[model samples]
Target: MRFLGFCLSMLPIPVIQQAGLALDRHLGDKAFEAQLEELWSAISTANDLVSKVSTLEEAIQEIAKTIEASPTLEAKTSEFIASLGSNQKEFSVLTENQSYQELRSSIVHADISNFVAIGGSTNVIQNSTVNSERTHLHATDNSKNFVDGTTFQGSGGAVSMRKITTQGQISVQGSGIGFGGEGGIGFGGGSSISFGGNSNEVSGNCPSCNELLRMDKRELHKYIHVQCHKCKSTFPFKLPNA
Candidate 1:
């Protein structure tokens, strides 16, 4: 079922809607119809279209009703996309069953300016300057936050469970910044600076139990193995020179 959703999510919205409409017209089994509805809901949420469409099934119904009533569908879609850009941000309210894969892909492709995800697991932020105040303000996931020439700036901008992988440069500046979470990773190939008064930290999760392992930046040089108190398991870590 997950694989089906994965494949369908990659299809163009128009194609999916057409397939759904065809099924609606020809299919009759209630069980099969229910399954198709569930799949549509999952795909809609995954594609970050739930905000525009409460459910793909509903959207298809609306399309059926409007297909003959209008001829400017392309213009409407364009206007919708343009309006989203006006906010200069992408936001999602996710449940535990959801991941941020589709949304992350959008960020990477579109160079999205800001993002916010609430209550989702395995969230990722990459290849863009994410507003610290907006991204994952309240969520617990095995998050991997990357800074490829990106800055996680602002007061109260604390990234937990983060493995700062620098490709260009990363700066975790501001007071009251701390790191602690389940799992994290960021990719880059440049120098990183962690300063601005009490703001030098690193963290990652245990491979065995996914428990958070955190430490101050000063202790990174001597750091070799991180032990998870929850599972009594240890993992090796190689720190970049801070």
Candidate 2:
């Protein structure tokens, strides 16, 4: 029990101090110290029970029962700390699937220019920048069925564009995950420009192709050059400090 006391003493001083303060508020310093000592003894007993238990599940059940039966708040706190370690171990095991590992590896190795993962669990970009004439990005998950026994599972889509200036147009659409479930969009800085969907006609015409220029407010901020789909000719437009 001396070793157990030492281990408990080595825990974060602030946590123990906070607990002591709480106990002192109700039980006084002398009673709090006595309760803390008793808690260490309970922890030692629980450790011994864990060693004697046949299986991990049995040990957890027994430890939970012991914690529930504790008379002092200190003992209950010690039990809760022990439970945190067990929960962390269980979490590691739950995430250690071979398929998940493979999926993670594939995503890590993939050189994704325009990524669209549909109808499955997949990883998305954390941060990225795109500089191009026209950037058309779309990630749609329309699959009715899911893999790996996960019913009603939806696909995830993410794009991060920083200091992006598109010459022509940028169309981004991500729709339908699990039965009318919609995907989300997150943009930072000047990347918040929206290009396609509904078009509002601009005042000018294309210089090269002589076609009418049509765009939205978001597009007008990002695109300095416009392209005509009819003639496939690109033309530059003059904007104020843009």
Best by lDDT: 1
Q: Model 2, 164: alpha-carbon shift in Å?
A: 30
lDDT of each: 0.36, 0.33
Tens digits of per-residue lDDT for model 2 on 15-108?
A: 2433333333534456545655666566557567744766654554444455556667345564433322221111110111111110110111
Alpha carbon lDDT at 143, candidate 1: 26
Model 1 segments more than 4 A misplaced: 1-83, 88-90, 93-95, 98-120, 131-134, 137-150, 153-242
**Residue 160 in candidate 2, Cα distance off native in Å:** 23
- Against the hidden reference, what TM-scores do the models get? 0.24, 0.20
Q: For residues 1-242, what per-residue lDDT tens digits would candidate 1 score against the true structure?
A: 33233323433322344334433443576765565465445444444433365565444434333322445532443332222223233333232333332122121111122222233232233333334333322333322223223344435553432333221222232323223311123433322323222234467778876766554444445568755533445678877565
Report the Cα RMSD per candidate. 17.7, 25.6
What's the residue-level lDDT of 81 in candidate 1? 26
The prediction achieving the highest TM-score against the true structure is 1
Displacement of residue 142 (Cα, Å) in model 1 is 5.8
